[model samples]
Structure formats: structure tokens, C-alpha cells
Target: STTAMAGSGLFRLPAALNPMDWLAQPDKPGISPEPSYQRPQGGIEARAFGNVVHLLVESMANAIARGEEPDVTQWHPRAHALLRAEGIAPGDLPHQTQQVVRALENMLMDPEGRWLLAPHTAAASESALEDETGRHVRTDRTFFASDAPLASGEGTLWIVDFKSSENSGSDVAAFLAAQKKLYAPKMLEYAQTKRAQLGAETPIILALYFPLLPALVYWQAE
Candidate 1:
């Protein structure tokens, strides 16, 4: 007696296909058996740290897109609040604030990071899109880069997803390569979706940006 609508909320996309989950790995062993106990009053856990960085970068990118300078001083309170919301202890506010501020500084100072956050035509942060299957996808950032060799009238469309993964291993090159491999599937989906929407004539550059490492790994989305 009921007809199913394609875009109905009930038929939402699988979370596993989300870019956020592409690089997700099993939790590493922590200092404490209880997860909450592992994050001390003066410390931040990996997920919380990643959240802080992502939020900060999103805010900064949005600002740049609007032709406004991102103010670092204004972000401290916001970062503190986000950390608290993510379960950081009240006593850890100062330490957490410094950690986030340092990350913001590092991103702003790095040429590659800055370029990723730079303004471009039709720039947007956390841009949500939908696919033909009625699945919703949220891209970390999207914009049109006019500097690219013209493949179409609008130049190149860029889809950038940010990752906060840090490497503790000795082989930095291997670490980056591994990350790209892990996320390639989801990134390809993003590129395919855009290509379907924008047509094959447009050039699309799909990239993974690791701000913490101050590195960028990118490839053409063909």
C-alpha cells in the first residue's frame, strides 16, 4: 500500500561509502582499558584531534572562499568548545587549544596546505552532493580551478578530501602511498559522481590532502 521514493531519507547512503570512513582503521591500543580514561584532562585523543583540525580547516577555507581573512584569535574559543563537545576534559582546554592552534598555524604556513584552502571559483567547504542512486555524499571541499589546462569552458573542477592521519613509521613515502591506496575507492566514487553530473568534457582533479603532514597527493580523475 506504500510507494518508495528514491530520495527518501530512509534510503540514505551507506556510511561505509563516506569519505570519512575510507581511511578508518581499528582503534589502536590505548593507555587505559576505558576509552574515556585514556584521554587525560590535559590530552586529546586521535579522533578528537582530527575533528578539531577538520573543523578549523573548514572554517578557514570557507573564509577564504568568501574573500575574508581567517582570524586565529577568533578560533580559540570555538576550538575549545568543540574539544569539550568531543569529550575533552575541562582541564585539558588549554592544552587542546594549543594543539589545535598549532595545527592551524602549520596548515596556513605550508604552501601546499594554503593552496588547498585558497579561493577558487564557486568554492565551497563541506559541500553535500547526491548521486543517481539517491545516496548523499559530503565532500570536504570543492572548487573550480581556472589555472588548469582547459578541458572545458569552466576549466577544472577539484574535489579535495582532507585526512588528518599521522605517520609514526619510518617510511613517510610508504605511509602516504598506503593512505592513497586506502582511500582511492571512495575518491573514485566522488570523481565519478561529479563526472556524471558535469559531463566527461570537464577536467576533474580528485585529491587527498594531509594537512598535518603538510603533504598533498593528487591524480587526474579519469
Candidate 2:
């Protein structure tokens, strides 16, 4: 269930749950016509798993733009703060831990503005999202196209579901369970909020990225 987490002005989402079917069999890898499910690239869908790479990059950008150090748990805040001149105390974390985090942060921010990666931005940029964008609705309920809340350029939302049985131990059951527990509630929350934001229902777009079967299971509320 999409529990309403109240806190900051923005909704506080529970820890994200990756469906078992989200990743394909690490052992039985193959290609499929699925859009978001299968790795657009390759390699057992490792990079494409939840494809949070784009988010990680964009977050780095936002952190840079803000000038606030994103090193929440830097191993060595003392040295880091000294370098940035933040004059902050080094937390209890180990020096090596801090170094690793700082390195990752540096790597992400190194290119800086050169990298503009986000679902919407990348999709529009490559023009692949158009071909990739799809609509999917909950199997338990049905909503009309007009009943949708806010929508993307394709006039809908996307749930890029990935399914991996090889990694998850059980394939079909795991994938389906993920769709219901992890993806479905999240999609509903997105639909509800988009509608609230735009003051109207926007078509819901759900894309299930299944790497095991190499298929993108799509659903829409229309």
C-alpha cells in the first residue's frame, strides 16, 4: 500500500521496493521487444536496474547548484569541510569511507552541467521516450483516460517495471508480486498527486521493465 508519509512539503515515500521481476535472470540473459523492462543497453540489466543512474546524476547537479555539500555521511567531514571551507566537524565515520563518498560525489559532479540526465529531459532529448513512453493501469481497478491526473508529454505516467527471476530466485511469482506490492501502489500515488497538482486527472502510464523475460509490461488507466 502507498502509505501517506507526511513530513516535508513533498511527500515522504517509503523505502522504494524493487520488484523481484524487475531484474532478469542473471544466468538466462536474452533480448526482448520490451521497452523499459529490458536493459536498453545490455549486461544482465545491471545498469538499467531501476535505472537510478539518471537520478543519481541529476541529484548531483541539484546539489552542486545549491552549493550545499551533499556528503550527508562523509567519512571525513573535517578534511572535506576544510577543503570546501565549511569549517564542519568530521563525523564518526572512518576516513576511508569519507574518501569513497567524496570520490563518488566528485565523479558525479566532475562533468557538472555537461550531463543533463533525467527521465523527462533524456526522453525528450533522444526522442526515444516517445517510442518508449506507454500507458498502464492497475489490474485491480480501471480509470478512464479523462480521469487521469497530471501527465507527461505523452500525456501519461510511466512505471518502468523491471523483472528478474534469475537473481530473485523465483521468476514469475516474484515479478508479479513486485508489480502488485512495489509498482502498483507507487503508480497510484503518482496518479493521485499528478491529478492534484494539475487539478485534473492525467492518464496513467505504467511501464514494467522485465529483464528476465526481456519484456516491458505496460499498463494504462484509459
**Alpha-carbon lDDT, every model:** 0.65, 0.33
Error of 1 at 35 (Å): 28
Highest TM-score model number = 1
Model 1 misplacement above 4 A: 1-44, 90-96, 146-154
Q: Over 4 Å off in model 2, which ranges?
A: 1-153, 159-167, 210-213
lDDT by residue (1-222, candidate 1, tens digit) is 011111211112222333233222233333122212121222346668767777789889878777898997887888888888888878877887777777788778876678778865566666656667767666777776532322222345678877767678887778877888888898889888776655655566677777666667776666
Span of ten consecutive residues with least summed lDDT in model 1? 1-10
User: What lDDT tens digits, residue by residue, belong to model 2 across residues 51-167?
Assistant: 332323334445644565554453244334332332223342244234434434444443311222222311221011111123332221121211112222322333333233223
TM-score of each: 0.71, 0.29
Q: What is the alpha-carbon lDDT for the whole of candidate 2?
A: 0.33
